[model samples]
Target: MPEHGHKTPHLQEHLLNIPVPDYAPELRQLVFDYTLQLADTSLILGHRLSEWCGHGPILEQDLAMANIALDLIGETRSLYQYAATLEGKGRTEDDLAYLRSAVEYKNPLLVEQPNGDFGDTVMRQFLFDGFHYFLLKALKHSSDQGLSAIAAKSFKEASYHIKWSSEWVIRLGDGTEESKHRMEKAVGNLWMYSGELFMMTDTEKQLLEAGILPDYTSIKQQWDEHVAKVFSEATLEVPQQVYMQQGGKMGKHSEHLGYILTELQYLQRTYPGLEW
Candidate 1:
């Protein structure tokens, strides 16, 4: 296993050894975009979870949320590092993370949505975790070895996240009348955003063709099964099919993302290269 902190030499070596075909430039660009999508989701969702740093409903839950946020931010750093290298633009991971405009981010809108209540946060995490679990599982076999390495490392964390969030979903949904009501509301409100997870953008399509990205169709079916099983156990109803939300992957986002960026980018933008 790669060490938690510091650069992973093996990952760098794997990236360097990636067999480039004739259209290397185009391939690199597509991979860079795909990587940014990964990084942006983790980065944005990490920030959202960090908002609960000292505000979790209980002490243990507080610590768990914070630790999960740290894990997500760590994953974001690894992804952004690879993405920067792929871009060949002399940009650091910090540059790609903290310096981007709201419109430049490629995260799904589901991640950027505000953490509402504990029920809301857990439902959001559960939905994303379900999809992320399968996505990372598939990416572990990617032809791009660097991505495979990152996916392999991140898969462990995603597994824990899925387990934790799914348990919370069942707990809250089956707990009390109020808790069940809140969980149901959270599910309904967030269902529209979930569809965007399976919608392939052009970048993903290109990477899929090149064997650099996984086929999301099968992943979506797996996500549905996992979600249905959990919801059934919780005695909660999955929201009815509706027109699903879109566009966050294409740089179009809800108004909420702007507020997130304002806080996230403020110190970096104001200080112009400040470091901790």
Candidate 2:
């Protein structure tokens, strides 16, 4: 395995040194909320992936999933650092990540859902990865330079995640009958949570008006096409249900987020100010 230590300094420099653009208080607050949404989603999903660390069906897949988890957590750190700076509240990334209650987190509910099985995990990842690819692609052109920089870095990893997850979706859907059944079941279970990805909040609306964020209306169309193509290839039926779940953007979350925070915040809550 490669030593990740050599990369730490560079990562820290990028996270700590990104220039924050001067904007109105309202705009800054909107951007801060948007950054928290991004960070929370990444952190929650990364935590889900990390749960697969030693339990993967194969050794190669275990390591690959773990590495992907690391990439997501690293991206989450950068986003949290930027959000802390934007808040101008003397809050560190650790505070934003570890000290917040579930109600304060803005991650989409899809990310907080339990990882039922390998099939469930892959489907969840595929849906999010598809949405994230388009989101990061548009964010790369954000008016906020710091956010754009973070988006640029995150897009590369999102691309890999999309590819990996999409392939697994196809492989399972088109493989053995048992695999296909499980994959299909996973897809059905997750379809409702997927809609929250494109649900724009008031903060996002303001950011859209200010050109700090992309119009998700168009992004949703692109996402639909991308998902449709992948689902067709996977021989999976796309759920046509229009009753999409929402509220995560507004900080209302599913019960699962509470459990996630309990485990995630344990070390920080138990040993305040502790660090390596």
Give the best candidate by lDDT.
2
Local distance difference test values of all predictions, in order: 0.89, 0.90
Ten contiguous residues with the weakest lDDT in model 2: 7-16
Report clash pairs, candidate 1. Answer: none
Task: Evaluate residue 52 in candidate 2 and report its C-alpha lDDT on the 0 to 100 scale.
Answer: 95
- Which parts of model 2 have CA positions greater than 4 angstroms off? 1-16
Q: What is the overall TM-score of model 1 with all chains considered together?
A: 0.92
**What 10-residue stretch in candidate 1 is worst by lDDT?**
12-21
Candidate 1 positional error at 184, Å: 0.6
Model 1 over residues 185-218: C-alpha lDDT tens digits?
9988898999999999999998898888888999
Best TM-score among the predictions, by candidate number = 2
User: Candidate 1, 265: how far from true, in Å?
Assistant: 1.0
* Root mean square deviation (Cα) for candidate 1: 4.0
Clashes per candidate (backbone, < 3 Å):
0, 0
